[model samples]
Target: MAEVEDLLEGVTVRLSAAEEIRAKGRRRRARGRAVRVGAGGAALLAAAGAWMLLPPGDRGTRQTVATATANPFRTDGVIQMPRADELPGYARWHWTESAGLPAGAGRRSGPLPQVGLAEACPASFAMTDEPGQERYSLLYTGRDHALAQYRVIAYDDTATARSQVAKVREQMTECGLRAVPPTARESEEGSRAWSGTVQDGRTMRVTVRRWNSWVSVAEVLDGTPAD
Candidate 1:
């Protein structure tokens, strides 16, 4: 009976040792799985941080889309005169908006048919005036022997601008101002020129031009009239 008891005790001790080995193997496998999961989470976090640190211009397609959404394209609708240096002649001339006398003011001398007529004259382009018409003028001076005036007139439509030019042309003939070839750089569709000696004998030249719904009148007086 004592020998049988000894054998059963030995069998019980062997069984307990095998159970301990199995438990150790399970714990090692669970620790390996946990390490792999931690490594994958750290890699994902590194990638996210790198993307956040990139420059705005290097942000690629997202940056371009955001910029286009902020500012939209626009068309210029306002009319502006040329700068003083942009004029054809002397670049050092002084320019002032809405300055100087009107185009033909006080320079007309004559026994012409329209001499005593009202202000509806070609030299001033008064026929181009209307209710919604816009007009801008710049006087240019500072040269030793010359004086200039630049004028711009805007109408509602191109057709009305053409009509205005035609009326001025007809009045110019009736007013005895001979038509000369255009010499001004602003010459366009309805360009017309007239030159004559003013009351004081200074050479006065007037050039009128039409561009779409706009008209430009350029007047130049070269050399002073002798007193």
Candidate 2:
């Protein structure tokens, strides 16, 4: 069996390469050159960039934004996570730095963010390039106990977002760490929800939804997770 460290290393390498690509992209945008050149490429870029300009209410479908109470901002690289008052039990949410992940990669504590999920089941669930991605978790203040996590990823198109959601649904079945009964449902037309337990025995309710070209994943534990 592959060790967790090995899997993390692989993810780190890929993320590093992705960061380089994004950096180049930033420079290109700085020069004010067309992001995608030649033959209808401009049209494609327009479509991809349109999501960023959409108003909060116009961003999502009939389904609410996954487990989040608010719509995620479309600004690239800016993570607008739910605030303390926004989350009933959580006093505050904090950013977590994962081992082997590039400083640019978004990560947090709570219910094992996306990087942790990839480490747990590398073959089944792995990280991929995105226009922008971020993770956040509830701050563990030692007194108040709450386990909640959130990840938001932006893609170039809705198709890519849909594909990610499908992969997550599939992971719920393929990964053997599942302890909680895997229940998958479409809370609304364009949203999905799944509940399962990780190896540490945290019963988590994960909700996924896509709006335009963005996808959000929220994980809220049924109770305080094992320490």
Candidate 3:
């Protein structure tokens, strides 16, 4: 009887020890899982921040941003710029938005193809106004001239043109360019040359010039509403 009792006590001690071991194993597993989760979360947050702070463009490639106000010319899911008469005196501008130095960053002239950029440059694309803006523009310069011309295309109301110009002028000032207010410098008789800015409520402007059919133009695209 004594031996039996001793044996029973030994069994109880062994069971208790097994239970304690299981509990320790569970605690270790939980701790390891929590560490992994925390490390993963940190990595994800760092990546998101880097992406947001990077300049707006294709990664490592030269690109441009074009901002267009709401109600911009649209057809078949594509945005079309309006003629100057419809909105009046609005032109556009382009700002290069790429990291690394562009390949063909030099004097270029004449109107480029309206659609995609050329592959010859590999980098250095014109940034059009983002369609997200209230007003927007596209710009081009001559291979021979120092003046950068732009076209302002906007669909905003008729009241916001000057404000658009002021904003764009500030941006251009950073690039060592000044807003040349509209002057009759190049007007010829009835065919007037426009250098002045017009606000179409979208708050935009365009650098305008008249020479042949290929007018030199730069545009300032204004944001309509941030969606």
**Winning model by TM-score:** 1
Better candidate by TM-score, 2 or 3:
2
- Candidate 1 regions exceeding 4 Å error are 1-75, 88-131, 142-145, 174-176, 184-190
- 123: Cα error in model 2, Å: 5.5
Output the lDDT of residue 136, model 2: 39
Positional deviation of 208 in candidate 2, in angstroms?
0.9
Please provide, for model 1 over 1-227, each residue's C-alpha lDDT reduced to its tens digit, 9 standing for 90 to 100. 11222366456322335567789899999999999999999899999889988876578657655654421111266556666765544444443333554444433212111121113233543333353567766766545435666667777887887776676556556544667786545443336787655444555566677666777766556544322
Q: Please estimate how well model 1 matches the true structure, expressed as its whole-model Cα lDDT.
A: 0.55
Q: Which residues of candidate 3, in runs, are more than 4 Å off?
A: 1-16, 56-227
- Select the stronger candidate by TM-score from 1 and 2: 1
lDDT (Cα, tens digit) per residue for candidate 2, span 70-167: 44444465566655444323434332322332332223422222422313334443444433434333332212233455566666677766776666
- Candidate 2 worst ten-residue window by lDDT: 109-118
Ranked candidates (lDDT, high to low) = 1, 2, 3
- Candidates 2 and 3 compared: the better one by lDDT is 2
lDDT of 3 by residue, 43-154 (tens): 9999998887887654433321132223324457554544433233323322332222123433332222111111212122345343222323433322111122233244
| Model 2 lDDT, full chain set | 0.49
Q: By lDDT, who's the top model here?
A: 1
Q: How many backbone clashes does candidate 1 have?
A: 0
